[model samples]
Target: MSEPHPASVPLLEVAGLRVSAGSRMLVKDFALTLARGERVGLIGESGSGKSVTAAALTGLLPEELQICGTVRLDGVHYNLVGASDRQMSRIRGQRTGMVFQEPLSALNPLMRVGRQVAEALTQHGTLSGHAAAARSVELLASVQLPDPAEAARAYPHQLSGGQRQRVMLAMALANDPDLLICDEPTTALDVSVQHQMLQLISDGVARRGSGLLFITHDLAVAASICDRILVMRDGVLVEQGATADVFTRPQHDYTRGLLAASDLDATDSSGRLFTVSSAAGYVPAAARKRVPAAEPAVPDVPNSTVSESARPDDGAHSDIRDAEPLIRVSGLNRTYRRGRSSLFRAPSEVHALRDVSFEVAAGQRFGIVGESGSGKSTLLRILAGLDQPTSGSVQVAGNEVAGSRENELLELRRQLQIVFQDPMGSLNPRMRVRDLIAEPLLLPGEPVAARHHAGRVAEMLNAVGLPPDAAERFPHQFSGGQRQRIAIARALICEPRILVADEPVSALDVSVRAQVLNLLADLVDKYRLTLVFVSHDLGVVKHLCDTVAVMHQGRIVESGPTGQVYAAPEHEYTQRLVASSLSLQPGSSLPT
Candidate 1:
C-alpha cells in the first residue's frame, strides 16, 4: 500500500507499552516503530484497546488510566510517558496531531469553523491575525471543502458530517506535525465522503512526511489506506504484516474471522450471510458448516399477517407482489424555515425532502441508500410519525399520517416502530434494559402487569440474540453490538408491523455489523415484518434489501430491484455512488 521507507532512521518508536484501568489491563506491551511517511492501521473490534492505544500514544487518555510506555518522536529526547501536562501540551499540537472519531463532540459547537482552525494555529504561536485566518481557509481548501471561505464562517452544526470532518483534518494538519493519529475519523461518513477524507489524510501525511497511525474497525478501509496492518483483539496484537500479506494470508483465527465477516459477497449455500462471533470462538461459516440460526428462541408475536413458512428464502418478496403497499407516500416534502436573514428579511427555507415518494409492501425489505442530507432521514421520520411532512400524503397501514395530530397517531404509532442509528444516544442510560424494552408496551394511559412486561421483554431479548440476564443491565454496560440488539429488542417489543431502521449498523465494527445484519434478516423473515432500512452503505443495502431506492438531494434518483439497480445504475449520481462504494478483494490493488 506504500513505498518502503528506510528502517535505520525511524520517524517514531514506541516500546514496552501497557495501559491499565485500575486492576484491569487495557493494552498489554504494545510496541511499534514507524518510518517516515508510513501509514499503519490498527484494526480491532470495539473494546479491543485500539482507541486506548491511540490515546496512550497521544497523551489523550483519561488521567486515571495508568500508563507505562516509552514514546520517542523523531526529534524528542525525553520519554513521553508520564510527562507533565505542560510538557505534553507543548508536544500535542506542535509535534503530534490527533483526529478523534466524533468531530462534532471534539469541535466546539459555539465556535466558527475557521476560528477554530485559527485557534489551532495560534496555540503554538505559529501565526496570528489575518495570516492565521488566511492559513485556516487555505487548510480547509486543501482538504477539498467546497467554498472554503464560506465553510470557515459556518458553525460546526451548520456544516455536514463530511465538512466537519474536513475541518478536523484542516486543524490536525495546521502545523504539519511529524506524526498524525486518526481514530476512526471516517467511521460515520458516507462512501464518497469517506473516500475523499482518506485521500485527504493520505495526501496530508505524504506532503508533510509524517508517520500515520489510522485506527479503525473497517478492514477494507485499512487495506485501502494503510501500508501495514496490525490486528488487535482483547488488548493483544494478534497479527502484523504488510497490507497484502495480512489480508491475503491471515494466520490468526480472529483475523481470518474478521476478513470473512467483512466479505459481504460471501454467503452460505442457503443464501444466509456468513458472520463471525468472538464469543463463539471466532469460527468462520466454512468451518462451522452451518448458517446463523434464523429461527430465534422466542415465539411469534401478535399482529403477524404472514407465517414463517411464507417468507422467501432468498430475501425475495414475491408473496407480497399483489398486496397493497404497507406504506404509501405521494409528493412528500419537508421544508424547515431558517432564522431571519436580517432584522426585516424573510427566513430561508431548507427543503429537506422534495417530492419524495416510495412504497414498501408488507413482508418486504425496502432499502433507502444515499449520502448525508439526502432526505433519507426525513423520509424515515415521516414514516415513523415522528415528523410531519410539509405537503404530501403519508399512509401507513391505510392511515394518513402527514397531517395527523398527536392524538390521531395512536394507531399509526402502534403499527410503526423505529430503530435509530446510534443506539447509545437513543437508549436511556439511566434505565435498565428490561424497562427500556418494555417501556413501549406501557404506552400512555395503558399499564401492563409486571409479569406480562417481564415475559414480553424476555421474549424480545431472546429474539434479538441476547441473554435473559441482559435485561438487568443498563445501556452503558453492553458492547456496541449488544447495545444495538437491545435497541432492536425495544423496537420489536410491541411487534409493530412496520420497522424503520435508520442506519442501525453503520457505526458498528465489521464483525458486529455482520451479526446484527444477520439477526435483523432472520427476525424480519421469521416475523414476516415490513422493514424500511436506511443506510449510506451501498454494499449493505445490496446485501439485505430486496428493493432499493437511490436518493440524491431530496428526491429518489433511481429505484428498482436491488440487484438490477446495483448491476446497472441509470442516474448519474447513482452511478457515481456505486463507483465510490469501497470493496476490497484479496490481492486487490489499493489506493496510493
Candidate 2:
C-alpha cells in the first residue's frame, strides 16, 4: 500500500545531502522532508549516517566533515553543503532544538536544571528571568517529572536517566521550536521509560504543532511512534515510506539486511554455540535451503564446536536447594538523603530501592531488566559492594555483606567486579593499557611481580580482541569498542567468579556490540563465572542470559528462565519490553 503524503508544506527539507570525513563519504544523497506538525523517523544501524544527517540539518556537523546539500528550514533556504559555524549557530537552538543520545553530557552539569531550560528561552527571545524560570518549571511538569518545582533546582547528576532526558526535553521545547530533532533520545533508557519518553515527545510535538525528525537505530521504537520512516545506509536514503508499510515490506536490500540483523531468534536447543558471521554481502536463499532441516535455528548463538560442548552446568548443581547462590540479597533497601535546608526543614529522603531480593547461581547468566528510576543500578551497586544497602542482608561467596569487616569486604571485592556502560569514562587517561589491566591484580595477598603482570595483561588483551601491543597504548588512543574491551580485561584480571556488567554494550556500535557480547560469553564459559548482566537491550539479554528478571519501581516483577520469560511474558511491562525491541523482518513478533 502506498503511504499517505504530507498535506501541508514541509517545515524542513534537504536535497542531495552529501557529507565526507577525509576521503571517506559518511553520508551521500540523503534527502528528507518533514512537514509542520509531522513526525518522521530515520532508522538504521550504527554508522548508518542517521546521526550525521540529523546533525547536518542543524549545521552541527564536526569540523572535519565536508558537507554538500541544500537545506531548507521553513521558507529559508541555506546551503548546508558547506555552511560556516556562525551561519549554523544562528539557526541552532532558535528555529530548531536537538535532543542528544546522552543527556548527561548534553546538559550542563554546573547549572540548575530549571536555569538551563530558562537559558534556552531567554537566549532566543524577550522572556524575563522570572518568566523564563516559571515557563521552564511548566515545561518540566509537562514531561511528567515528579515535583517539577524541586526538580528544577536539581543538577543533571541529581536526576535519573529518564529525569535527565525529561530535562533535556524541557530545554529543547523552551523556545517552541519550529523543528525538534531527537537523536537516539531513548537509547539509554529502559523499555518502559523508553516508551514513556517517546510518547511524551510525540504528545508535546502534537500539542505545539511542531515538526519532528526522530533519529534512532532502534526500528521497533520507530514503529511505535513514527508517522513516516526513512531508512538510511552509508549516508543514503535506502527506503522511505509510511512506518507500517516500509517495515511490513521493505524494498531495498540494505533495508532488508538491517531487518534481518535485528532478529532475536533463540540459539538451537541442541547444545550448540552459534557464532555470528558479519562478512560483507547477503546470504543466498539456495545456500540457506541446503542447511540440514534437523538443525535448530537460534538467532544470535555462535556456531562453534567449543560453544556446543560448553553447556550450562545445570546438572552439576542438580540439588537446587543445596546449591549456594554466588550472590544473594535479602530485604535489601537503599535511600538517598537530600541536602539540608533551613533549621526547621527536614531532609528529603529518596527511596531508590525498597527491600529488593534475588539470588544468582554460580556459572549462571542472570539478567536484570527495568525502566529508569527503578533502582536496577542501585541493586547492582549493592551487589558489587560499591554501596551498602540501607537495611538488609547481602551475602557474596557465603559472607554476609552487612556484618563483614572492612578486610572481609575487600576480600569479597576481589571475587566481584563491575563493568559500567561508559567505558571511556571508567578508564584512566594517564594509565597505560598494561597498568589498566593489571591494576586489579595488585591486591595485598597476590604475589605476581610486575613482569608476570605484563604477561598476564598481554594474555587478557588478546582474549578480548585487542592486540598484544595494546598493553602499551593509552585509553584515549583506542576507539569506544576497544576501550570497553580494556574495561572487561580490567574487571576479569583478578578472575572474579561473579562479573556484574551494567549496560556494558549499550553505548557501543551494533557490530562492535556483537563482538563484545561473544567475547564475554566465551569468558563466562572458560572461567565458569556467574554473570549479572544488566541492560535495556532485550536482544542481547536473550542471546546471553540463562535467566531473566524484570524490575519495575525497584521490585522484581517477573523472574524465570530466559526462554520461559521471553516466550510467555506474564507481566504487561515484560510484554512491552519484548514488543519494544525492533525486528529486522516486517510483521515479525517476538517468540511469544
Cα lDDT of all candidates, in order?
0.83, 0.76
Give lDDT for model 2. 0.76
Q: Candidate 2, residue 155: CA error in Å? A: 6.1
Give the C-alpha lDDT of model 1.
0.83
lDDT of 1 by residue, 303-404 (tens): 111111212224346666457899989999999999997998999999999888878788888889999889999888888788999898999998899779
Worst 10 residues of 1 by lDDT: 302-311
TM-score of 1: 0.88
Q: For model 1, which pairs clash?
A: none
Q: In angstroms, how far off is 148's CA in candidate 2?
A: 5.1
